[model samples]
Target: MTSGRDRLIEAATRLLTESPDREPSNRELCDAAGVAAPSLYHHFGTKEGLLDAVVDRAFGAYLKRKRGMLRTGDLVADFAAGWDLHIEFGVQNPVLYALMYGTRATSSAARTADDRLRKALHGLRDAGLLRIDVDTAAAMTTAMAVGCVTQLNRERRRADDPFATAMRSTLLETVTGLPASPSEPEFAARALVAHLEATSEGFTAPERALFQQWLRTIADTTRTVQDGQHQ
Candidate 1:
């Protein structure tokens, strides 16, 4: 058996999700939930209270999935997926996504999502994929994602739209300074790591691992410095 509160939430969810145009009036909500007007007041105190609950229930899953993303070590691929999910969720739940991020005051859930982005950017830095510090990368990534989603939500981008991919690719290229194709230096270094393993390189597995690590540091730094001088 559910209480009046749950019933009201369920009804509101069904109605609002069906259409985020506007909130149902108290009478409509009460009628849909089979409860009295005062029951809503008794349970939620005010219409805002009920709306807050509705927002929480709607966005909870989005937050969870955002926090859990990109477990694979492929930072580039992971961030691309993250961008897709952000745009998709926003496009699907415009009213709620806007309400959550539309405000100057971010909710706790939003902050948590922001933290996850920073952590992922840091992972990119660890992989020698970042051109800037972790903080700058995270800020740039967050800003770009929010801007993309907000604009796409306004434009009502479809699943097949190329705008999301275009914007994501552009932002990543600008921030990371990576070519559209794989970096030649990084490619050569990765091939060397594989060759070392394939030929046994007169070393054990652990020794090969350490050698590859140092090689990556040198190759990444060399690229970074060269890219800087050309700017």
Candidate 2:
């Protein structure tokens, strides 16, 4: 049997995710989780705490799935696998994503969850998994995944349809800088790692002064490129 705290978190996640208009009241959360009102207060202290717990659970699931697929094999293949997992999660748990990203609750738990994801991505960058520069690459990848899922959610399409196939292809191509074919390896993972290491080592200060400078340069260049595309 799940513990009361676990049940509370699970219940809060469901309530918060499914409620589109406003935050659920504590009483509503208690009913959803099958816990008594005092049990909710005893475990979380307040509704905010319950929300934090929910976010933690959601992000925990996301990181667990992300880390599980990382292997020392081909980085490109690993990336594709990771992306697939992300899309899968987005589809399966739209409510979780909506709650995590949409809610305006203030709890240390929520910040902790957000920080955990950032640190995981940072480690991936340090290990040479993702591109070092953060122009729109990270944001764009998120956008694509969320956008694809959003469309599917709106259309109420089956998961095993052409839309999913095409969205996965598009995401893989855009994020990895590779073609959507099985035969070609983009080497983006390798290049990203090398770029991050070089940028880090070239820094004159341990505070990452040089790396920050380089990132700014890249960000500016990326913006110019994007503007040109618009023009």
Candidate 3:
């Protein structure tokens, strides 16, 4: 059996997102959550707390799907995966999505999500894959993503559709300066890694090991001169 807190969150997420047209009353939430009014109050303290939890639960779900994907050390691919996951979440949970984002007010959850995205953008900058600074890249990518999600909500289109995929691809290429065609930097890096692995490049064993290390440093772009510029 789900805990009261969990049930409340689940119920709120479903009710709010499934029918933005209808506001769920406390009585409705209590019924849907299978909890008494006292239980809701005891768990959340108040209606505001319950609403906040609903928003948190919504974003938490998005991040959960994003984390499920494997990390290939391919920044571009990782970004694309994250983008797809974001769209999927918005499409699947339009009511929850609109509640969280339709307003211009930035909640703690929204800032947290943006910070997470900024970290990914910074990784791309470190990889030499970005034409702009990490902050600019993060902002541009985020703005585009928000715009796309808002459109998806109103247009009522599945994120899996070709139109959504094209928007993702076009925006990614435009912001990161990565190729919309082939020869993306990540692909080149992977190809180079394979070549070095196969030929050993006429270097000593230790040298080849260090060479791989260098490649990782470049791809990771983790430690840069101005890494402090971003969080």
Point to the candidate with the largest TM-score.
Answer: 3
Candidate 1's displacement at residue 186, Å, is 21
Candidate RMSDs in Å, in order, are 11.9, 13.7, 11.3
The 10 consecutive residues of candidate 3 with the worst lDDT sum are 182-191
Give per-residue CA lDDT, model 2, range 1-231, as digits (tens).
Answer: 998898888777766566755778888888887888899889989988777777777666666555544243444555555555555666777776666655632445446544543554555556665554434455565667667777776777654457866776775566455555422122223223334443445445655545444544554454456558759
Off by over 4 Å in 3: 103-108, 182-231
* Model 1 / residue 44 / CA error / Å: 4.4
Cα lDDT of model 1 by residue, 1-231, tens digit: 999999998888777777767778988889999999999999889877787776676667676555543233447755666666677677777777766666512656567677777877887788888888887777777777777777887777763267766777786787677754334455345435544544565888899788878766765665576668879
Instruction: Rate residue 77 of model 1 by lDDT.
Output: 51
Candidate 3 is scored at a TM of: 0.69
What is model 3's C-alpha RMSD?
11.3
Q: TM per model?
A: 0.62, 0.59, 0.69
What residue runs in model 2 are displaced by over 4 Å at the alpha carbon? Answer: 14-22, 32-38, 70-72, 104-132, 183-231
Of the two candidates 1 and 2, the one with more favorable TM-score, higher being better, is: 1
Query: How many residue pairs clash (N, CA or C atoms closer than 3 angstroms) in each of the candidate models, in the order given?
Result: 0, 1, 2
Taking all chains together, the TM-score of candidate 2 against the true structure is 0.59
lDDT of each: 0.69, 0.59, 0.71
